[model samples]
Structure formats: structure tokens, C-alpha cells
Target: MWNKRRRHFESYPEIVIVHVSGYGRPESGGDPKKCKRGCYDIISQAYSGWCKLASTPEHEVYRLPLYAGNYVTALFGAMEMLVAYIHAQKTGEGQVVDVAQFEAIARIIEMYYTQCIITLEY
Candidate 1:
């Protein structure tokens, strides 16, 4: 879904902006050992692909931050959205949607490109 959306936006340059949320989540389920392995595999694949595509001569794959504060990130995201909306209203253009965690996760997979391509599910 994300790739399709990206392509759509690329094709239609009139898409002035995009506001996305809930892109931070643990991408595995159940037992801790399996979850960790699964998460590692998923992240490794993503990083591998990113490394292949990156145009910069030098690249670094940084680890995700381990924050002690539980809701601080979410609060920051809300503040960002608020500021973006105000800016958009002042400028009189663009759109904003409160994307949920599940929706955001679903979009990250390459296979899910068809979801956005064939439906408005996102």
C-alpha cells in the first residue's frame, strides 16, 4: 500500500503533501523469542533493501531508539499533526488523516501494494 501510494503521488505531482502516523510498532507476535527473531528478520530485510537503493556514498543503519517514556512519542506525533493541520489550513491545501497502527503496519509490506492499488482500504 505504501509503495502504491508513493507511486500514485509520484505520478500525480499535484499531491502536494502527505501526513502519515503510527509508523512505529513492534512487528511480531506471541512468544518473546519468536517475536524477536521475526522482528529481526523483517527489519534486516528492510534495511538490506534500503541499503541497495540508497544513493549516498556512505550509509548507516541506525537502531531504533529504546525510550523510557511510554507516550512521549505519541504526544510528539499529535503535536506535529496539530502544527501540520494549522499550516495546511493557513495555506489552503493538502489533506490529513489519523492513520492507525494496524493500517500503517499493513502498508509497510511489499505485497500490500495491491491493497492501495485496487482499493481505498488505507
Candidate 2:
């Protein structure tokens, strides 16, 4: 189904295709078994360490009160789409934007951790 759509879209150079998934392209890396699994907000949070960051003092972890993973994934997906669209406009060639929800959440986590590390004294 995706292959067919990709082929069809190949003719439309101005179109920017965005593929958002839980893990990412199966051929890329990670557990192939999990690549077949679909991910939701809670799943992404758990896999991406968001739940750990949101854990209570007792070490009881939980999903964010809101669906932060979903929203963040969407925001990142949108950003990728826009950047790909701009590239396509300039090159007159369409491109696929592959966004993994896990990576998107991890990016936010990594960004926060990096900032903390930079500010830490020891």
C-alpha cells in the first residue's frame, strides 16, 4: 500500500510525503519484530524514557497526564514535512519524510538532558 502510494507520488515533484511510525523503517535498524508493531502515546513514552522522566518520587512511572508523546511526534513530523517540502520546492523533486515517534520523543529528552549537562557544575 505504501509502496504503491510512493510510486504514485513520484510523479508529483511538488508533493512532500511524510511517514510517521512507532519505530521507523524496518530496513533501517532496531528489532524487526517490533518494527511490525504499532505504537501509541503511552508506548512511545515508555520506549523513549519519557515515562522515566515523569516518574514519581517513589519511582512509580506513568504516562504523561496529557498525550505529550503524540503531540511532540506530530510537531516533529510537521517540521520534517515542511523542511522536506522546502527542499522539494527548491530541487523540483519529491521526498519522503520518515519520522519515528520513538526518535521524536528521544530527541526532546536528549535535548533537555544535553542542556542540563551543559549547565551542571559536576
Candidate 3:
């Protein structure tokens, strides 16, 4: 069982387990770039695009206030934790919450496409 400190306790009565990660399980000496990009290529994965948006084209990278991808992923992580919390209240069973930034952003982009196809609203 993981905790807010980002460590797993791995025992019963696990109150809260939140895994907020940029990439899937950490590996030894992996490409720092690839870990950030992950398996999907979405706008949230576009570091260059994000930098361009923030008006800092000096390099392909810049420190933004929100860090959009991580921020959104963390929000999703909180939502997942909330759902798990509600379930725990009902069933008295705790579960781990694994949330990946790339996955969240990819899902968000996918949902946008889905909405565009279904309603052509945007």
C-alpha cells in the first residue's frame, strides 16, 4: 500500500495509496526524455509545444508554474483517491491508486477527439 509520502507500506488496513508517476514503474538508467514522453504522444506530452505556449522559446524546456501534465495527473490522482476513499467507506476495503501523467493527458486528449467526433463541438 502506497502513502502520500510516495512510499508503499504493503500491509493491511492501508488507508490511502496514491501512485503519481510520470512513467510506469521506475527502471535503472533509463532515458530521462523517454520517461517523460512515455508510450503515448499527446499535447500534454509536447514539451516543446508547452514551452512555446509559455512564451519561453529559448530552449525546448522551461519551468512553468503549473507543469500542466503533472498538475493534471495529480488532480486525476486525487480524484482516484477520492473514489477509493468512498469505496473504502462503503466496503471497508482499501485499494491502491496508480496514476500516470502521460496516461491522464493521453486520456484527456483522446476524450477531446472523442467529443469532437461525436458532437463536433470543438
Top candidate by TM-score: 2
Over 4 Å off, model 3 = 1-14, 26-44, 47-65, 112-122
Writing each residue's lDDT as its tens digit, candidate 1 over 31-83 gives 34432342332343343342232223454543223421213334544665677
Clashing pairs in 3: 1-10
Q: Best to worst by TM-score, what's the order?
A: 2, 3, 1
lDDT of 2: 0.82
- Candidate 1 residue runs with Cα over 4 Å from true position: 2-68, 95-122
Q: Model 1: number of clashes?
A: 1
TM-score, prediction 2: 0.80
Residue 98 Cα positional deviation in candidate 1, in Å, after optimal superposition:
11
State every prediction's TM-score relative to the real structure: 0.27, 0.80, 0.53
TM-score of predicted structure 1: 0.27
Q: For candidate 1, what is the lDDT?
A: 0.40
Model 3 lDDT, full chain set: 0.59
Evaluated with lDDT, which candidate comes out highest? 2
